[model samples]
Target: MRSPAPEREGDDTLVWNVACPTRPSSVPGVAMAGFSDRGRLPEGQRLIPHPAVTLVLDFGPAPPVVDAADGRRHRGSLVAGLGLGGALWARGDDLACVQVRLSPVTAGAALGVRPDELEGAVVPLDALWGRDAARIGERLGEAASWEERFALTDALLARRCAAATPANAVDPEVNRAWDRLVASRGRARVERLADEVGWSRKRLWSRFRAQVGMGPKRAAKLVRFDHAAHRLAAGHDTARVAAEGGYTDQSHLHRDVVAFTGVTPTGVARASFLTVDETAWPTLPLGGVNAGKTV
Candidate 1:
């Protein structure tokens, strides 16, 4: 899949060769995509935040570098938490990597860490996975094709899930609440979610935050923003998108678009990060359990 060439001056014209696995992963809630740059990578490519944990395994000749709004720089393989609010920029050349998106419901088990620990943060994979991180990078670099890389990644994630301890398990109630929120596209009420889960509002909020890395309300907003951003990218008018996307008014939608992405709705409509989805991940569910499910 090819993204439109970036508009910035002096940036390379990037053409990405995107590949998807021939079959679904054995592990649920895990999705992967492979991207190889046909030319030098675009400079300072902004990344729009989504509502799922992201893991990038870089095995290109040169490692990619990500710069955060806070002025921190991360290189090579890394994991980014949900809801970063469009504060990250990726810059590199000769990029080749398999990107994985993990649903919050299963991220803890697959990552061997509480999702909450990663909120709004990007960490080097080796920091969490130790020597195994380096080993996987080496193996991925040695793989002969994208298909082999996908298979290797799926096997690694499955092993991690299988080895997760009880402590990494998410509560069934939390899972249910997440499902409802996704199904509603973040239009679901928190009080109603609490009641449905048979828990008080306070209890539900605490548990969801602890297990999912953010409060229920924040998660809902992120999910809602994700939906609206895509519609805008599809060329829908802002007023119509606001009306049907659970916003009280066009202004409300504008605020959200700016809040989550640090850009106006118009700007977001043109974002390469979002526009690329049409081809790179045409069939993926954005924020659900099986999100990022490529062809």
Candidate 2:
């Protein structure tokens, strides 16, 4: 049974319209989703910025295109490292893709590469995986159905995860720190996190940035902003959202929202991207009302 989940649409083109489930339990810090966008639109998509690194595997006629804020162009099945306040413009025809979100914790293992190498950049998957990336593409392209593709992806990730040791693969302390930030809804202080992780402030700062793609302070701020953005989308008042989201005041909250999304808090309240997230990633806090449903 296939379903339609429209990510965005217009008179000419469509992507992400087929509704489906992204089982989060398949891999740590990784979620699976698929989108089919065909037809030529003058523009394609503006990636909704999230804290997670996105690995997109495209099996369309031509690879998807990504124009980053810093004037970099990327194409094909690509891995986007952790981002800070930027949108990737995706444009082209036949933009079918399967995307996986990798938590900084699982990046080293799942990617067989390091997040630091890709931070603030988008690179073809082959760049990291060499021949394996091509093999995966061939397998995905030959799969008869989306379900099969999803299963293959799951198996690959599970195998990698099994091989990756928590301590040896990446800094376990950094993983714990990230968990704390997520648990606290991004409100946890880096200094406090350092104390808990048994690292000095400077060591934590350097190592966290090296592995996670951004310094701890910046990552925390981005996490906090994601939380606030969701609250605003859920129809909370700006002032209340601000206070609850850990801003000094409404003005502080306003600045952060604008900086992150290029929109005011009120503007974010009307974002459809967040609305789509409810069904796409149920475990995400933005996924409140639509949690645990597969269409």
Which digits, one per residue and each the tens of the lDDT, describe model 2 over residues 48-137? 567777778877677778887678788788888775236567788776777776676677778877778776577778988788887887
lDDT of 1 by residue, 83-186 (tens): 65255888788988898878788888999987899876888999999999989999999999888999999999999999999988889889888878777888
TM-score of 2: 0.83
**Per-model C-alpha lDDT, please?**
0.80, 0.71
Regions more than 4 Å wrong, model 2: 1-15, 19-25, 38-41, 162-168, 266-271, 287-295
For model 1, what is the error of residue 267's alpha carbon versus the real structure, in angstroms, after optimal superposition? Answer: 1.3
Counted clashes in each candidate structure = 0, 7
Where is model 1 poorest over a 10-residue stretch in terms of lDDT?
A: 286-295
